[model samples]
Target: MPAPDLSVSATSAVRVAATVLWTGPDAPREIDAPIVAAVPDPRGWAAGLDVPARRDLADRVLTQLLAGEPVVVLEERGDWLRVVAPWQPSDLDPRGYPGWVPRAHVAQAAVPARTEAVVTVEAVRLEPDPGSRGDGLPSELTYATILPVLAETGTRVRVALPGGGSGWIDARACVVRPTGDGKHVEAGAVFTEARRFVGLPYLWGGMSAFGLDCSGLVHIAFRALGRIVPRDAHDQAEAAGRVPVGEARPGDLYFFARPEKSIHHVGFAAGPGSDGVLLHAPRTGEQVREEQMNADRRATLVDLAGRLAD
Candidate 1:
C-alpha cells in the first residue's frame, strides 16, 4: 500500500532505519537513489560511493534522521519535503535543523504512549510477532532510535511506529524507560559508547550506527545516553562549556577550525592534557579511529575544548 501524502504544516516522522537529509531536491546524485528510496539501504548506499563520490556528499547532504524521529513539514515539491527536525537543534533554523528529505521516507506522526524503548545496540532488526498483522518486513533500527512501547512479552517488545503500525524487537536490544525521563549517563559512559564504533566508516551527514560524520558521532553518543546536543560542530562548540585544552579529560569535545573560521570538525577526547588522543569519525573514505593529537591537528585544534560533562 502507498503511504499517505504528507500535509504541509503537519508533523511527520521518518519511517526508515535512516534517511539522508539532502540540502535540496536537486542535491542527490544518481548513485544516491538507493538511499532516497522509501526503504533506504544506508549501508549499501555507503558501500557504493567511492572516495570521490563520498566526498561530494559534504555539499549535498545536511544531516540524517533516524527511524521515528519527528520533523515539521514546511513545504512539499513533487517527491520532496522541506522539513525541520526539532529534536536536532541547529542555528540554521530557529525551529531546528532544516533540510530536504524524500516524502516517501516519512509518515504522519503517531500519538506516542507514556513509555518508550530506546535502542541500545549498534543495530537491530524489528520484526512482527507470529500471527500478528503488522506492517512490512523487519526493519533495521540504529543506535539511539526511540519508539513508544506498546506491549512486552518475556523476550520481545512491541513498539509503535510512525506509519500507524507496530513491530516487535528483542527485549535485550533496547531499554524501556518512561517518556521524557531526561536521564543521562556520565561522561565516562558517553565516551564508552563512542568507543564502540571505532572502526565504523565515516559518512557525511550520517548519524546512524551504519555510518557517522564527525559531529554525528558525538551527537548520537550523547543521545544514546539521553543527552541532547546540537547537530553540528559549530553549534555544539557554542553550547558546551569551554575548558582549556591543557585540562581536557575524556568525553570532552575537541573542535577544529582555522583561526577566525567556523568549526568544521569534532571528536571525543580520549585522554587528558593538551595533546590528548581523540576518537572520532574522520573525513570521507576514512573510518572512525583513535589517534594521538598530531602536529597537524594541533595547529587547528581549538584552544578551549567543549565540555559537556566532567
Candidate 2:
C-alpha cells in the first residue's frame, strides 16, 4: 500500500515504541528491519546484535523518537519520511532536530485535546480494555513518552494514541500535567532523574530509557522534569549559561571537546564542591557510569560548565 500523501507542514505522531531515525533510507541493514518496521521491537533489535554490530549502528542511526511524540512532516521518499521533531531542539535545523524515519512508524491523526501524561518508568505495559479492538498499539511504552489522557479510573489511565484508539496504562506509571507546562525544577531533581539510568547501555543517537547517548541522557533527564534542552552536546553548550568549572553544581552539564574542536560529549556534574565527579553515557560499547574527572577526561573537558536556568 502507498503511504498517504502528507503535505509539507502536516503534523504526525510516532506510533511505535521507539522509532529509529536513520541518517537516510539506505542506512538500515537487513537486520535492522525489525526496528524500522511499523511495529518496532527495539529490545529484540538490540538483543539480536552483538557488541560490534550494535556499535556499527552509529554509522546510520541518527536518533530515536518515542511513542506519541509529534513531528512535522517535511517530505516523503519511497519508504521514509523526513521530519522535524520540534521537541528535540538542535541547531541542525531551525524547526527542530531533522531526521528521516520509516514512514510506517508515524501516522496523521487529530491532536487530542486533554491533559498529557509522561511515562516515568523504564517501560510500562499498555493494555487494551476488555473486548476492545486493538489498533496495533505497542505493548510497552518507554520512559518520557507523552500522550493525551482520555479517561481515568482507579489504578489505570486511558490515553489517546496518535494513531487513534486508546490504551490503558497503570495510573502510577505516569505523571499527568498540562501540555507545555513550564515550571522551575531544581538542579538536584534533574540530577536525581538522571541517576536513574546509571547503568543503561550507550547507543549512538539513542534518546530513551531503552538506551541513551551522551546528549540524549542529558536531554531525557531534563525532559522528565518538564525541561527541554537541546538534543545534542554542542547545541546544549551553546544554549546554556556558562559556569566556571570551579563553581560547577550538581545537575550542571559538563561538555567535553578537544582544543578548538566542536563539543562532542556531555555529562552531569556530581558535585558537592566541584570535586569533578561526572555521570554520563560514555561510548558505544560502554554503559552509563559515574567517575571522578581523571586527567585524560580533564584534557578535553571544557573550561566552563553549562547550567540551564531554573
Candidate 3:
C-alpha cells in the first residue's frame, strides 16, 4: 500500500519506545568519534568541526522523544524504524514526516488510556502534588507536549509522563481538545499563535513554543490550526502548491534557500508586498520575530508557497 497522504490530518497512538535521542528524518550514518581524534587541527577548529561526524546518537537531536506522545510508524528497516512523528508532520512523505529512529526507541506495547491534553504554557513543571515543591519532574515540559489526563484535582490535573511515572500539572496550564478540532482552524488563528513566540530564542530542531528553528516555527504554527506541514523547508516547498510572490497572503509560507539552491528556511507571510512582514526564527541565536524581508533576503525566496490553513 502507498504511504498515507500525510498532508492531511492523521494520527495513531504510540509512544517513544525508549528515552531515545532523535536522529533526522533520514537513516543514521556512523562517523569517526572522539572529536580530538577525528579533527586533529586546533586552529579554527570549532568552525571546521562537523558536529554529526564526532557525536553520539544522544547528541545529534532534532527533538527529544517523550515516552507516550502519539506517533505513527511507517516502515521498518532491520534495526531502524521509520516513523511519522505527530509533532513533526510532513506533506511530502505519505508515511507522515519520517523520523528514522531505532526500533528500540519506539514503544507500542501499552499506551495508557486517558483523555488527551495539550500543554498550553511555554513551560510547566510536573509535580507530585498541586503545589510547588523542590522535587518535581527532573525537567520542565514545553508547550504542545501531550499528556494523558488521569485525574483532575483542585486547580491541578494529573497526567502520565513519557517514562513510567505520573505527575500533577496546573489545571490552567493545559487544554483538553479533541483530535479532530484542528481541521477547521482559521488562518488568522494560526498567525495569531505564531506571533506569540516573537521573542523566543531560535532552537534548532525545536518544535515546541518554548524554542523552535525556522521550519519548526512554521510546523508549530500550522499545527495550531490543526493542519500538518512537512518538517523541513524543501519538503514543505514540494508538498505545498506553488504561489507567486506577488500573490502571497497571511498564513502562507515563504521559503528561503540561497547559494545552496534548496529550501533551508521558512516563515509566515503576515502582510503583502515589500511592506509585508514575515514571521520567522532566523538563525541559531536569533529570536522568532516579524520583520520585513529586505530586498537581499527576499531575492533568495523561491516562488514556491504553501498554505496550511483553509
Model 2 spans with C-alpha error above 4 angstroms: 1-10, 129-132
lDDT of 3 by residue, 5-91 (tens): 222232433332122224543423333111122111112222233434323333455553443455677777775666766545455
Worst 10 residues of 3 by lDDT: 32-41
Q: What is the Cα-based lDDT of residue 40 in candidate 1? A: 83
The Cα error of candidate 3 at residue 24, in Å, is 8.6
C-alpha root-mean-square deviation, candidate 3: 7.8
Shift in Å, residue 279, candidate 1: 0.9
Ranking by lDDT: 1, 2, 3
Q: Residue 304 lDDT in model 1?
A: 92
Instruction: Give stretches of model 3 more than 4 Å off.
Output: 1-59, 63-67, 71-87, 90-114, 129-138, 162-164, 180-182
